[model samples]
Target: MYRVWNFINNYSLLLVAGALIALIWANFDTHAYHHFVEYPLWFNDWIGGDFTRWANNYGEGFEKFEVGDVTKVLSVHYLVNDILMAFFFAIAAKEVWEAVILKEGSLRGKKAATPLIATLGGMLGPIAIYVGLAALMGSATFDAISRGWAIPSATDIAFAYLVGRVVFGAGHPAVRFLLLLAIADDAAGLIILAIFYPSGDLAPAWLLVSLGSAVGVFVLFNWLPRMMDRGDQLRPMSSWVRKYLSFWPYLLAGCASWFGFQEAGLHPALGLLPIVPTIPHADRAFGIFSEAEQYLTDLLNQIEHMLKHPVEVVLFFFGLLNAGVEFSSIGTPTWLVLAGLMIGKPLGVTIFGWIAARPLGLGLPSGMRALDLVVVGCVAAIGFTVSLFIASVAFDGNVVLNGIHVQDAAKMGALFSFAAAAVSIVVGKLLRVEKQHG
Candidate 1:
């Protein structure tokens, strides 16, 4: 019973279950799925009022100010994709910051160069393959589908980590390498999202305001601690006061940044990212779950621990919201994404890794062979959560582009990551990459 509970609690399992439920539910009753997602939630008598009219009236203040005017007509889907997923991206940002900046981390200094290069290949390869295929179809199709070039560029860290554990065991060097690559991939994906995907005309003033808020939080959280250490009399406070009060600035700044991004026509999931590296973090010497006193001092670590389970739940809902697609809706863009992820990912990883190791003089980690790189590449092909998010952004509601059809197809392609997982398992078994038990 305990084992079953643990298995169910596992992150990968939870994500898989959520995706499975969505797939089944969507396929079983497509109408029900659509209706459930589109069900309106608002606080007013005008439940099904014209949205554009409401927006215009609210903006111009012609109608009386009321919180009830705000409505989420497609409540469930948007809530999960737009709001809940922000925390997921925040967590990813935190992980990337820790890997690159922490002293005892794997990706710090010269050691990071190899994995960073590999990540570049991992990104470029998919774009090349996807764009090349799209180009062959015709100029119009190519231009439209090219927006999703980054869709296959992400490797879901949890899924890839699980597959790595099974293939290379718990303590293998390959696992660490894969982890670093995934982190770098995430960093790249975030950049792509910010640069390529904007909701409306970019508002520089709002972006500046967001940056200012992040800076303010950094000053409060980081500078305040330094001041206390210097024995500044004005900054004197009890330990408990300092510990608890420090969290508020982060919350405030995060809210400001989210709003700012919304106003700036950018994806708000990236709002907390610039703030993560600024938050105080403990050295890696204090193990991830350590109860050591220093662990309590690290606000970023504390926030991450606090949000872990919540983020997991959000990811489950994320899968449920985004993974639903009809088989009949799939087309060329879907096949292109599948090919990009499944074939291009592994090929790019292997080829680029060789370039880095051989000519670039960055040697492979100890106990890792060339063929092991191939297996790791296969694992890297498992792109799910972030891929789907990119898909949503890429095809969202542009009428001239057959946006609805393309969006459904892109989503189907993202869900097809299960095929990549199966391929990884097969490759791992063929290579005899088994867990070593003492």
Candidate 2:
């Protein structure tokens, strides 16, 4: 019997708080709750949802303000989901970049090979079950919810890590393997979001602006200082830039990149990704997604530290905006999402992990067994955060199927993924996993 608040009361405590409040509010007073979520903050052409699109989605009752051709409205939802959420993704992208590129990076070398393969299984399994089962329900049912195939594939890194600790103890090899798989899954989820879901019509040319900003920042702020400081034991130029200019140049580049994505018809939440690698970083990271990272004295980590609190607030608002669902909304889409996560994730991870360990010649981490992969999959199945985000993107409308809103139903499934935590604990005890304290 895992407690809801207990599970959510960590780094993501605010997020879950926001979600729980949204759920209660929506269920209690559906009309008022939606009004709050979609309330307009600003009306400008520079950055917001298109006025026509917002009107169409919300069904024509929303008031539109026009200031001589201002055709966009920045709703509370857009401010969080489309704008502020970019910072959240930027931080996620930062960790992923460090984990992959920095020396002693977790995702490097043959040691990462098996977990990487398991990540693929984690992804493909969900898609196979979600889409395949929907297809079996006949073409019409499939047509309505086919876009949500990616929802179940997401592994909320924070929640999964917490559950991994509970299931295998802090020091167990499976815990590390689960973290690696979840990180890889997050990387894959980002790519899937970028490639599959476009905010509007395609405009690849605007991506050039994002790329150019990245290049310009690297040359002027990052690479130039080091080049100028070459052969100088004092390293004065780099130090000067670090102290004086600081993260300003990169921040400016991030804004430009964000606008580029907004104008490019891609999801603007991923906009800051290009600018992350442009900033200066430490040569090596202590651990991937570890607390010791806050101690590192690199501009990248410093920027992350700076944004940590603001991002937490942003995540809170994001949850409030996206997770407002009524229980009646649960239907076929809900079941499909749950089935994909609970059933497909564990089965795929166990089978494919075994193959990767035995047939492919790659092996699990020391003290981890084939059965442990099942528990890892169970932990990974708690897909609350990223799954909720993707559900919002995949079914972002009031479209009703079988007299229920599909988006809300899908989000409900994501929220229900918390149940996987209890499942993981039970599975661990059933398998008699030896707990190893760090």
Candidate 3:
């Protein structure tokens, strides 16, 4: 456990390495690595063919038999976004808490401004780019079909870190700050996810139920420490309390809230809010705990710890998903998509981030020059996972938004972002060296 934490802490910068590996596989790896093959049919069927069939019929004939509707191919994306990714949220929430609450005082000042400004820039970067696109070229049809404006806002935390560590090296504070900024950027994007792409339909009773569930989590999390201190014996209150206690229980409660919110016409992301506050982390890691207590604490700690390197895992799945795209169907080389990611993303990030940063007295990192920021901006283009995620939820299985298919556009944009960042990183490095000699 400690080794995993250390690896993530020291090598969190390797996300780009993972992303690049995934990208390579996506483009070329057919020999051994499984790929995400894009079927003209629903994406769900393409990814989880038989498993989906089983999930939809597992409970048939049982008293409370409830099977998920699997008619839509996009359901697989939801499983990743809503179910599996919730754990990502749990981890992300823990990190954000660490940055803001646990390390609040120590993390302030000029040294910390990189992560702060970078995160802000990442948030603003995508929004500015998309809105700009909307103004310049977004047709009404495109706007209606492509409802996702915030997809580009996210930074692939894992990939960015990998690039920074390998290409730039960990000794560079700027690189480290850049990685942290990526993580913060992802958090900001998650906020956008919660606010923007909520499931349609707002039911009052469901809203009330969600509220009640939230209250229960709040009460339970607050009192669990006390309950543990009091005794092991389950009280009338204890049974209810136990339901709210434990990581998995809290996760279940979060799931319930997600469903309630979905039914109530609120964003499912809100379901994560209650548990976000409760995700286990020692607010003050001052003292050690007893062996028994420490074991439980470690369990909570693991959730947050694993999230630190989500880029590797996310990139792998993204590659798998990307593999699903049928190249022959799209009359374009995947490289065209890569080109856009390479050029468009960095241009957007540098312009917006520089514009935002210049107004303030904040300066770029010591060794990082303006051109380096451009490279960093280039790295920002790797938006495959989050962009795809946004596209899936925003379009609701509607393939074409405007004239272009939403999924196609998303894949195109992501590949473009990746290419733009990769080329820029190499170019930026050369420029950095020449500047030093000059």
Candidate 4:
């Protein structure tokens, strides 16, 4: 329920700056902006997008630029999205890991019941609306855009957390409720991305490599050290490992896991996930949007702290590469994404939230009225970060619907979702939410 004002500022400002720069740059010089995004940095078979994809996007000239018989090109876009972004997802996984597994974790027990159920509505409502609307336009239109149904289901944790404070105040029970819902939504979104949006053809056998690396690192670096020091009160062996070995072993495991994902044809952005649980973590979770998180000494939080600034830099590039949609690209997909977030999110959250709170014998947090669920939904509608990521994954960037570039149109919808912050404020005032503060 606590907030870290600076964490929000640092995370959001760079991303917004990059997005704004991308929008201006793209609008000003569309061809050049696209070129920069796909600018190839490395050429090799081990990592990066295929050289064929790069050559197709850029031109026949790119074919001459290839050195040797390289199979892949590590372009600027792929570096940020596929490689560096793993750290960002790893951080999210860390939070979700603690929330589900830790004793006092927020996502456990009766306290989590309503928000968990509400998260279901939050996901389903967007799908029903997005797909239903697309279906209404006819099957041809539906076939083109139906894969994006999961886009609107995302809730950008940092942005939604920021807006939730403004709408419900830092101390409001609804703010806590909103945070829990957002975390649950993110957890679901990760699963959806992995299962439904594989980056290439499946090679399920390669996943064994990832599994082996995770187990090897956990046993050697984590569980084994503790077992050797079982009866020693000083815990000398564990301390020696923590102090000397540090994150080195896990770092190696993470790289192996990432490569396994890339080879296995899964989205490599989620590649660091398998290693998250293997790392030593704190017994208690204070939630992501809190300054208290900095005080945790567990290896997981320590690694996250180390990654904080680097992840911020990664997010900036993420926005720059992904948010370059032109204004003219707006079309059916855009409207569908918007309606799914703004219209569907609220109705679904409130409906299913009421079902859980009243019918299922769960109760709303103290001082949070049933109407507050509407405002929570509205704040959650600001799905900028994860929505944009999903939009990129959900469709081929080249797909066109009635001459509208479908991917660009969808990205624009994700960009325009920032409008939900304003909508949330207006709705909050209209609903006369009683602001509570610590």
TM-score of each: 0.86, 0.96, 0.67, 0.98
Model 4 lDDT tens row, 366-429: 9999999999999888889999999988888778999998999999988999999999999999
lDDT by residue (1-438, candidate 3, tens digit) is 011134343333343354456456644653323212322223332222233332342223222323344433333334444445555555555555555556542245665565566556555655655555555554663455336566666676655655655555556654655665766676677777766766554565877666676668666664565465476564545444445544666666777777676666655544665566654455543211112223444334555444545534653444444424323324121233343345445665565556545766566666666666676766666766666566556653334543444555555565455554456567667766232211
User: Candidate 2 vs candidate 3: which has greater lDDT?
Assistant: 2
* Residue-by-residue lDDT tens digits, candidate 1, 209-285: 78998888777667766766576555454244356776777777887887788678788777777777777777762
Model 4, total clashes? 0
Highest lDDT, which number?
Answer: 4
| Superposition-based RMSD of candidate 1 using all C-alpha atoms, in angstroms | 5.4
What residue pairs clash in candidate 1, if any at all? none
Predicted model with the maximum TM-score: 4
lDDT of each: 0.73, 0.87, 0.52, 0.91
- Candidate 2 achieves a global lDDT of 0.87
Of 1 and 2, which scores higher on TM-score? Answer: 2
- Tens digits of lDDT, candidate 2, 1-438: 111222134447999999999999999998888878877777787889887767665554575444356778788889999889999888778878987997777898888898888889988898899999999999988999999999999999888988888888878889889988988899999999999988888899999999999999999988988999999989899999999999999989999999999889899999999999999999887544456766789999888878877888888888898999998888989999998999889987888888999999899888888889999999999999899999998986767888888998999999999999999999999999999887
- Counting only residues 3 or more apart in sequence or on different chains, how many pairs clash (N, Cα, C under 3 Å) in candidate 2? 0
The TM-score ranking, best first, is 4, 2, 1, 3
Question: What stretches of model 4 exceed 4 Å from their correct place?
Answer: none
